[model samples]
Target chain A: MTDITALSEEQILEKLLGGNEIVFEQVFNKYHSSMQSVAYAIAGPIIADEVVQEAWVSALKALPKFEGRSSLKSWLIRIVANEAKTRRRKENRSVSLEAIQDSWSTDPRFSENSQWKNPSSQWHGDTPEELLSAEELKNCIEKSMLKLPENQLAALRLRDSGGLSMDELCNILEVSSSNVRVLLHRARDKVLKVIDHFQITGEC
Target chain B: MLPNCKQMAELASKNLDTPLTGMAWLKRKIHMLMCKHCSRYSDQIKLSSKTVSTLDLDLPINEDVKKNVEKTYQELHCRKDVSQ
Candidate 1:
């Protein structure tokens, strides 16, 4: 028995295409949430799981022809992204392509001179990584993430959590590089604000 | 030109996508040294981006769903092998 865990993903893909269930299952469990997040952002929560499942079926079909262009995770994510967009169209859901300019312009965090009106307090945690592992903070960040605009949420998830490149993000989101950057910044800013608020009040 | 806190925040956010260029990088750095708020904001955003990237969303696959999907794949693979 080939220890599926011992091999790299490329090796796993080789076995996976040759009918290794172990490799397939390992990769599936590892990537399902990321695939689902991409789908959820593009297709909404109602059918995100369906889209991910469908994408897997599609991935299986295309496994033989899978070229090693991108990493396996990214390739699967692209497939899920495509599936989500198609599903979105079928469901008649439209994503707004408007530039993400409004919130930044009127942000109450800064004054007319663009200086801090209310400077953020230092977080209690020593490091951001430490802060991320806290259950209360995670709850708050997750809640704040949901409240973000669809485009921003998708951009943030794909770029940050999904480990996709800016070029890939622009292609997936169908926006310019500048827009993708803005969307990501906006999304991150909201979460940062949430953490700042949480630290000061001890509430999410 | 020296950037204000709002501009600093904007630059900090954009910095995640691409590092600031020569003049822009210098201005932001100088401002960050001079202003505690902007410096804190920069640290917060950088930390935010790092932490957020590693965060797993709330969704977790159920054991039943995973088993069913694995079963379905196995069956399909078995059929393909038999047919081939």
Candidate 2:
């Protein structure tokens, strides 16, 4: 849709800081997808896109205050990261780390094949469904994720879902490696609680 | 019912990850040996996560946003506020 081919990070920064709208436009078109990946990796597709747009405005507004200490690409990405974190905070949703230890029986995401636990039925006929219905946990997880503590959710999305390493997550989160792991553990716990809570209520 | 309702229930929860283990694993083994509710709950959670993950979701960007982006740039870019 938007014609964003490519430009070195420096050139892109020049256009954006220069307030050249045309160059700005190109930069946006170029990085939007990558930004979405980061956003979605940090949150989800819905919030990712929004974070991208908001990051643009925030970066633009902050341009005058920009110091030439860092690369523009990294700086812009940090803006996006901050925006996504803020969005998650506003929503107040988060995935609980307890998912590992909690029961997701009620959440529709893990429905159907408890049979795997059935030693007798392991040899039974007609295989039951394997995966949980995404629709079932649709709004629940996303909403919960938004409510999670910013550090925890960001850790989960960036590392577990986004495939970022612990080091990378630490870099992105601007925290110590150990701190990132702690946040991730806590966040996962919260998600489990949500799923388990749903099971307790028989929603699963 | 399982021996430890809370513990088993907690263990029964693991459908959230791949090859779910740890506390959940102990929960399953304990429940399977003695408890029924926990076993069922665990089964249910696994089924739910699997079902949930399989769901096909297409969350689209707002149409108005696209229109606004295109329209604003087209209109604003075309105009320059100058001393008249």
Candidate 3:
């Protein structure tokens, strides 16, 4: 009944290398979602699962050579990102950066003068925990997230969920720092609006 | 010139990713002080970002995929053992 979380990186690496099933499952559960997000961001949803699986195979094959240059999670994410990118190229799927429209100028919440026409209402639950406590609201947010533009969704997932640096995001997404900021903002804004609407009306 | 409410909202989101400094920081501070709506919007965006970051967006790993990966892990180690 060892607590895997209490184990150091070296210890975890040792367990992984030794083919410890418990440690392996624990590590997999902890990072699978983030890996999937990175995969989805790069390779598109249709092939994201395949990309993650391939990345895992590659990672396991190369695990013995892991030098701990970065955290295990970061290393795994990098592997998945690379796998996804390669798959994207093979599929001839290019991320449509041009389709992301900056609707901020015409956003109905503001007037022609850029003043607040429909200012944000005070939310009942302020903290992240409180907001996600309701199952319906959580579903709404997830749905809204799924509807975001591909690049924006990728930027948001990589930067927020994957805990990647902005520079790393730029490198992975093949966009400039300014473009990354725009994508991140647009994605976050959509989530904010979804929450706002949910708060005002008890619907998703 | 101080940014309008719309610009303030955008800046607020950007500031969360990277802190605002210099004139941008000062402008945001002053605008937030004078505009309660923009202030609330900023707080909401921050909360949403925090929530999204903490969310477990992962669907359960498919059983087939899990089994295949596990099998691959074992085969990899078995090959290493043979090589040694």
Candidate 4:
């Protein structure tokens, strides 16, 4: 029904807890895409599928303990994040999220920067060939990213890719805020050099 | 207007997802209008962010995946918590 479609997630949660599997399915359908995106964003495409699966399991198990302490979606997402971490651990990898227990703290903007450009700044390169060629460029950069030290790779991915704040990066990576920023800047510098080399020399 | 350069940059990144506001945003906009190099840096940073965020990882969820996910969800009803 349109009314049910318009129901708040809270209402859905109530139905789910009331033992309505159909209502729970609704929640699953609603979040499935977003949940997968977040997991994939953190762990790459390979494990993201498994992560979401485990998250569903975990969410179902954790539901009884949720205690209505947060938004339904938020609680479910926390489980999703945990599942992503679990997948990372199983793979012996933690590229983007270092670990949630790190003591790093930061003021978000990082060390900060000056200036800005016109809002219209776009990354488009000239020529359809150039656009088509960017796939190669991304590969070149990805290869370079693999050469980075573990911490730097994690920091860069978390900051630039995950869009995590310094505080979040610190929490995820278990590092200091200052260290996170420093790691990010250094990693970025290296990536920039690699990208430049690829563009100029066309070599990986 | 906001506070410091670092704060502005941080806010700028955050604003990438949202909106700019307050004295800091206004001041940063002013600084941007006057500075080309910083603007370029910001743009580059943003572009790089997109590149890293999106990195060769996006794939459409084909029907097989949808079926597997649904099957998994159903099987979840068969077990208790194993997340410990």
Best by DockQ: 3
What is the DockQ of the complex in model 1?
Answer: 0.56
lDDT value, residue B80 of candidate 2: 51
* Number of the top-ranking candidate, with TM-score as the measure: 3
* Candidate 3: tens digits of C-alpha lDDT, residues A1-204: 656889999999998888787888888888888788778878998988899999999999999999998888878888888788789989999777874576776899999999999987899897988988888999898888777888888888877776778888888788888888888888999999999998999898
Q: lDDT (0-100) at residue B18 of candidate 3?
A: 93
* Tens-place lDDT digits, model 3, residues B1-84: 899998898898899879999998998999999999999999988998998887766465767777888889878764455555
Model 2, residue B51: distance off in Å is 31
Each model's lDDT = 0.81, 0.51, 0.85, 0.57
Runs of candidate 3 with Cα error greater than 4 angstroms are A1-11, A62-71, B58-60, B77-84
What lDDT tens digits, residue by residue, belong to model 2 across residues A1-204? 323346665555555555466776665554454445456645555677667777766666676577756656556656776677667667764433343332334433332643233211121111114212334544565567666554555666554444445666666666675566556545554554455565355353
TM-score between model 3 and native: 0.89
Top candidate (lDDT): 3
Give me the displacement of residue B79 in model 2, in angstroms. 7.3
Interface RMS for model 3? 2.1
Docking class of 2: incorrect
Q: Where is model 2 more than 4 Å wrong at Cα?
A: A1-10, A17-19, A98-176, A179-204, B1-81
